[model samples]
Target: MNQTIALIGNPNCGKTTLFNSLTGTYQKVGNWTGVTTEKKIGQYRKDKKIEIIDLPGIYSLSATSLDQKSALEFLTKTPPSVIINLLDGTNLERNLSLTIELCALNIPMIIAVNFSDKLEERGVKIDLNGISKIFGVQAVCISAIKTKNLDELIDLAKTTTQKPFKISLTAEKGENSAVKRFSFIERNLDKIIIKKGTTAQNKTQIADNLLMHKTLGLPIFFVIMTLVYFISIKLGGVFGGVIKNLFDDAGERLSIYLSEKEVYPFIQSLVCDAIIGALGGILSFLPQILILFAFMACIEESGYASRIAFLFDRFFRAFGLGGKSLLPMIVSSGCTATGIMSTRIIEGEKERKMTIFLSPFIPCGAKTAVFSFFATSIFGGNALIASSMYFLGVLCVGIFGRILKNLKVFKNNKDEFLLEIPDLHLPNLNDVYMVIKEKIKEFITRAGLIVFCVSVFLWLLKSVGLSGYVADRVEDSFLYVLGEVLKYAFYPLGFCNWQTAIAVISGSFAKEAVVESLCLLTNDVGALFSSSYSAYAFMAFILLSPPCVASLATAKTELVSNKWFFGMLAFQTLTAYTVAFIINMIGNIFVWCGGLLLSLIIVIIIAISLIVAVKILSKSKCCACTNACGERKCKNKEKHSTI
Candidate 1:
């Protein structure tokens, strides 16, 4: 019989790791809480018939957090044939609390003690047989990362006898229930667990002391970001140049051969310019993409990412953002779709909506590539310029966050922040490899599917026009006409040229297509740029605009309102135009001045605007609080106000 086994465990117990080992699936696994916020299913690799359901990691079956609620709903609605309760062996006493809760479900379960290698290394012994006898279920020690005894654990789970159902599913919620669970765990651990010595601070704690130091934390983050950009942009560019040359040589030979064969001009243009020119330009950055994800994998594996989140929590809360928003913003840097989905952890609808609106401000990998490419092409390979785009994106988030927080809808909704920091360990090379491999595969799929379609459409638009589908002269085409119409909308931003305007419009389809469309339009980027200021403005508009169609669809589903969806869309477009126009004006006025003068002027303008906006917002918020509370308590209310 093919058994349907459900894998459940507390957060960061390596439950997802074991699931991947059994099913050979690539669901994102991280050493952080709430990474897998939803359920996933995959067939067991050894037997196609056996299905494995990987539920979200939950500390208890109580419907408190969203992941916990999801796990409870799934099990209650569709009980599995067997349950694999993964336990962290090093923290056996704490993990047993959840095991005790699961016992009340009246379902058959086998305890698989994961992270056994770490426990053994610490000279800790867990008497699996003794615990099995007490709990009346099969128990085994297995290392999910090392793939040790997993087969035996699976077999034992498949054949284990069910424990007697005693505890009530509708157990009373109080301190008494929690005490009973703890007492039961203590009794079981007394019989099975043996410790060599008293626990003390280890290397992880020592490292955390330095890494999480309040004064040094923010600077450390900046230094790390600088290094990542240097490696991905500077080092990757060196390798990308080689790939570009290879593609260019091949394209030139193909073009010469096609001309000798007297191939049709349309066919030549499609093959040489549309396919090779457009696609090759983006593909050359593949090395940089891989390197960027690799660094992300390293940060995630090292457990420093959770620390960064913790470090930023207080500051983010000051801007009316909860700690949960940090993960979505971080994930969005990789892809906005996943980031938007990650907002499920935020229970408040108001906070979730705000997170969704702000997530697009963080440039995803595709946008990062565009920024890197333009920074190189225009600024002669300035990694600082590429990195500045991300810094600017973050600043925009803070400014916008302050404004959004004071709004009436978001007032008085302050979600609590809680997280468990995982112990530091050397990241497994194989895990890092899997992450990079998955990212590369996604990039290629998007390029082949969405980007390819957009590229073809752009070629068609530029090739055919009003004079009965003229093929060669694109200036008279429909694209030219449409670009002319949109040009005026962006005229203030100095993005008036038809080609530059067309690229921005094409970007709405897919951000990467901006570079692809631009490649198809002009052989010389300098020709399209009247001045360097316009180039920066164009990049800013693309970076700050609303996300692609796929991302918008995800936002719409989460938002569940057409009115809010369109509102967000309009807001993003206006914000992009305003920011770009401001930068363009600043750049034009300071062009004759040196770079240092321009930087000083730009900084001064941004600082003044932010200061004025914050003051106006603060006064409005104070008035709203007084109206809500009362005039007599206005002063006291302002002192304790959350919004």
Candidate 2:
């Protein structure tokens, strides 16, 4: 008989790790909360008929955030055959509160105590038999990371039968349900848990002391991110070169083979130039993408990512976001759609929607490919230029966030930020491998499917004209006519050419297509731009513009209204254009006028103009009184005392 088991636990309690171990599927396990924003299903390795569901972590069934709501909805609506209440062995006291709540559901359960390896080191011990007897469920000590005793845990889960268990969560007068639940956990702790030795000084505290210092925290984070980019882009480029050469050689050999066979030139160009060139150009960046995600995985697994949220909380609040917003932005560096979905963890509807709207500004792996390509072709492979785009993205978020917050629609509601900081430990190589493997798979899949299809389609557009099949005269093609009309729109950004316009347009479909389209259109992408400043301007446009269609769809779903969706698109596009225009204008002044003083003066003027514009736009008449018009405070305060 097929059986489904649900793995539920508190945040950062190793539930996903156990899921990965059991199913042999890598599902983006992390050291922090909200990693699994939705339910993930995987069939057991030993019994494919039996399915394992990994639900988003929750503190209780009383759900507040969307992710928690999802978990609660699933458990109540589609009750699983057995529930594996995964507990963090190191923090059994707090974890048991959730277990107590789970017991009230009266479903068959197996208590799989995770982090068993660390329990002894932390001077904590669990009475497994006592826990089993008290809870009336099977209990086993299993290290999810180490995959220790997983078979026994699974065996117990499969064999366990439903038994009625009474949970006495009786609250005294004026006591709340939350207190009663914890009180029951406190009552049971003496019998089920044992403290063997005195606790040692926490290494996490020591590390946090230096890493999260009030003054040093932000700088440390910046330096660490800089290093991550340096290693990923600069160091990974060495390996990327090898992959690039392999593709180049393959394209050349395929071209020669097609030529020797006397194949039609159209077929030859389509196969060699469009298919091989475009797809290969994108796939060649796989090494850099993998390296980047590997570092990110390590950051997540090492538990430092949560610290970053805490460190940036105060700083982020000033811009109308809380610490939780940083996690989604960080995830955005990998994929904007996933990042947007990650915003479900935020409780406030306005904040979550605002985060979803702003997430695309942070460059995803696809946009990273575009930046890396430009940095190589135009900037002589200076990884700093590529890395600077990431920092620039963050700056855009901050600038736009402050602006958006002033608007009534996205006004800050002072959402409470509660993040659990997991214990710091060396990143598990297995988890890092899984992260890199999954990301690389995604990158390759896109290159093979979406990019490959887009490349062929673009080649057809470039090859065919009004007269038909004018492969040699690309300028006379339909694409040329289309680009000619569009190029004027981007002329002020300094890249007015048809090819660059086509690339920019294609990028809206998929960001990696920007690189793919350029490689297909021209032999030398550098020649498309007149100056490095123009190239950087184009990069900024791509970075800040509405993300690919997939991310836009996600934003639509999250925003839950067509009006907000289109507004986001218009807002992002305008932001991209304005930023690119400013960058290109400043660059032209510096280059053409050949005076740093004049450039600086222009920058100051632009900055002041922007400040004044923001002030004018954000200004609103007081709802309290008509006398408050054009005044900082309402003059007739006593007339509308409530307001």
Candidate 3:
């Protein structure tokens, strides 16, 4: 028989750590809350045959945020057979509030106080019997990080029995009551927790004073970001080239072997060009993704992410977003699917939807590979060109966010923002390595499945045409015919070539496919463009457009409406086209006149067009979900409805 055990805790309380320790599952663990935005299930690798479901962290079961809703549903509707309530021993006073609330659930639970190792260093001790007596639950002091007492805690959970109990310790026990529950927890803490006198100044606080300093905070953040990008882009690029050479050599050998074996020409071309060429190009960038994830995991585990949120609270509010929006944008730099899921922590529906809308502009890891390729190939490894694209993305966010905020189409911009800052510590190397490993595994699996399938499909499109099943030349194929129709749409952006047009269209499926498609098309990406300016325009369009298909599915789920999802995609695509057109036109004028006069004239015309677009959008007051014929999805739907 399989047993089910649920791990519950407040955010940043080592719940995921304990789950990982118990099951050896490589679920994401960060020092900040909201890292695990959804429930995850893992079967124990040991002989116990127990299945563990790790629910999202929640302070209580009030069900305001999306994660809270999930937790509440799991506890009330589908309660686990046993729950392991994880807690942070260092912050017992605050962490115990949730513990006290859990006692009211009448489920069999074992309290496992994690971070015991850190508590030991602080000269703090938790009396297990005292805690057990107060909550009528078996309590164990264990450090998930240190792998101490985990087996014992699991054994207790295995045999623990559920019985009806009264939560009478708190006088104020009623629906939605929390004050008396907290007071009860405080009294218990006073009895059970023994702390050494006159504790020393905390390193976290000391670091925060300097790092979060009013004038120095932003600059310090920028410096750290620059270093992260430098290491991932430059250092990772060096290692990527080494891996690329190995894959290239293997592909050459395979191609030669196929030819020598007199394999079917179609099969040879399919395997060599489509499969090896496209898939190999994507796999070669694995080193960069892993290196980037390592640095990001380090930053997240250090507890500095919460501080960055605090630092940006005011700036985010000024643009009609709270600090919560920042986390999704940061996560998007890694993957947009996770980023969209991370928006669950945002309490405001409007902010959450807007966050989902804007996160794709942040340029995900796959896009970073595309940028790296462009930087090295088109711009001769000019780091500024790579970094400038990211900065342009940020600028687009601010500009677009402001436009959306002023439109009055979205409500709930003034929602409350609350964030808990965790104590800082050096990131655990084991945890960081595990995160990198998980990321690499995910990337490889995705590349193997999605990239492989897409590559085969593209190869077929490029290999066959109307006149012949297999074209003599790629330019005579159906893909080139299709791309010719699309290229005219991009003529304004200076990407008039059919090959570049197809590459851009392929990117909508997966951003990594952009470079891979280009590789399969021609060895030199630079030769396909008329000028460096046009190449930059192509890169800009890729950066500013809607993310890949997986992210779109996530957005659709989060938005809960197909109309809004399609609306957002259209909006983002238009924004990418407009931005790329402006950039291309400006670059042309600059090259033609070499001075400010002609550029100024072009800028004025572009500015007028932008202002006109914004004014029309803001004043129209029509439903965003309407079709081009000015008809809403349903006849009864109101005009100016919230998207």
Candidate 4:
């Protein structure tokens, strides 16, 4: 008979890490909460029949957040044969609270203490035998990262037997269950756990004091992100140029060989221009993507990500988001779909929906290709321009968040932020390798499947006309007619050419398709833009536009309502167009009015127009109540005060 085991624990207790070690799966693991927001299943490597289910990290059985609800539902509906109660060795006191809750379920369990390797460095010790004797379950100390004593843990799990253990609380009579549980833990903890000193904790505290300073914290974060982009874009570009040249040479050689071999002219264009050219342009940015993922992995594994969430909590609350929202936003930099899924960790429904609506503003890895291309070709290879797009996305999120918070639909009565900070340590090299490896695999897979298919379809559209097979006359092709019809919509934002219009439209399918379409349409991408100003406007449009089809589908599922999903789509489209139009108008002012004074006057006038527009849009329909205002208490004492 096959036995099923479930791994359950407090957030960041190394349950996912141990699952990966036992099951040999490459599931993403980080030193922060919400990394595993959904349950994952994999077979035990040693015995395939023994299934391992890695459930989302939960503090207690009380289902408050979406992730907790999922875990709770799964445990109650389908009780596993055995439960691996993973505990963080350094923070056993807090972790034991959940263990106490799980004990009430009466399921056979094995207590696996994680981070045992760090106990000595942190001046702490745990007696495994003593814990086993006290808890009435088999207990073992194991280091998931180091893969130490994992075999012993598995052995204990296989032969796990539950013993009747009752918690006798000595607290006050009216104490809550939580207080009673902690009281029991405090009374019994001294027997099995020993604390020698706080040497390691002191060092971490000293570092946090400087890094998390009130004034310096935000600036430090910006500096770190800027440096990450600098290394990823500027340094990686050197390698990208080499790859581009190789592809260019190969395309040239293949085209020549096809022509010499008397191949069909249409076939030659399809193979050389559409397939090779488009793939080359995108594949050139692989180094930069790899480097960016590496830096993100390092930040997550080094335990600085959770500190960022904590540091930004107060700041985020002002914009109607809790600090917990930052993790999803951070993950959005890689993939908006995954980021939307991560919002399950947020406790409030209003905040989670708002986060889902705003997360697509952040440029995902697909948009990274588009930005990198423009930065290299038009912006004089300045990585700052590409990196600034990220901050621009954040600015949009903040501006929209403030506006939406005042609206009745998105208003939150109270936003609570809760996060557990993990200890700082050097990133495990193996974990970093796995992250980079998985990211590369995804990138290549998309390039192979989506990009390849889109490139071929686009080539056919550009090749055939009303008369069919236009050959060299691309102006007479079917794609040109379609682009011509849509070009007028983008006239105010600059880049009114058909090619640029087509590229933007294709981006709705896949953001990377923007770059692929552009490469497939024209040999000189710079020629599509009239000036650098127009290029910047186009880039801004891409930055703020609704994400790709997959992301839209994800938003629909996450939002769980057609009305809100369509509202989000409309909001994103309008925001993108309005921002891009403003940028283009401002750039034209600088060009048309050469004098600095005149340009400044025009810019001020435009800014004033924008301010007025925002004020008008933000005007709320007041309710006849003393506290009608969503974000603030109404100043009017009379219920019939003037609107």
Candidate 3: what lDDT?
Answer: 0.82
All candidates in order of lDDT, best leading: 2, 4, 3, 1
Better of 2 and 3 by lDDT: 2
Candidate 4 per-residue lDDT over residues 1-643, each given as its tens digit: 9889999999889988999999998998888776887789999999899899999888887746667788888888999989999998988888988888887778888998998888876668788787877778888888999999998888777777674266555669799888888887888798779654465446668778767878898899989988987787777778888998998999999999999999999999989988888778778878877887888889888888888888887667667787878878887887887788778768778898889888888888778878988997788888788878988899889888888888899874366566777777788888999988897888788778777777788889999999889987989999999999999999999989899999998888878899889878887999899888889999999988998877888888888989999999988999999989988887887788767956678788789868866864565545555455542335553654553
Whole-model lDDT, model 2: 0.85
| Model 1 agreement with the true structure over 303-376: per-residue lDDT tens digits | 88788878887677666776778878877887787789878766667778888988899988778878877886
Order of candidate numbers by TM-score, starting with the best: 4, 1, 2, 3
Worst 10 residues of 1 by lDDT: 624-633
Give candidate 2's TM-score.
0.90
Candidate 2: tens digits of C-alpha lDDT, residues 60-150: 8865666767787787889999999999888887888788778878789988888888887777878998897778888889898899999
- Write down the TM-score of every candidate: 0.90, 0.90, 0.88, 0.91
**Model number with the top lDDT:** 2
TM-score of 4: 0.91
lDDT pick, better of 1 and 4: 4
For model 1, the superposed segments whose C-alpha errors exceed 4 Å read 164-174, 196-198, 345-349, 466-469, 588-643
Q: Would you list the clashing residue pairs of candidate 3?
A: none
Model 4 misplacement above 4 A:
163-171, 194-200, 379-384, 591-598, 601-643
Comparing 2 and 3 on TM-score, the stronger one: 2
User: What is the alpha-carbon lDDT for the whole of candidate 1?
Assistant: 0.81
Worst 10-residue lDDT window for candidate 3 reads: 627-636
**CA lDDT, every prediction?**
0.81, 0.85, 0.82, 0.83
Cα error, candidate 1, residue 453 (Å): 1.5
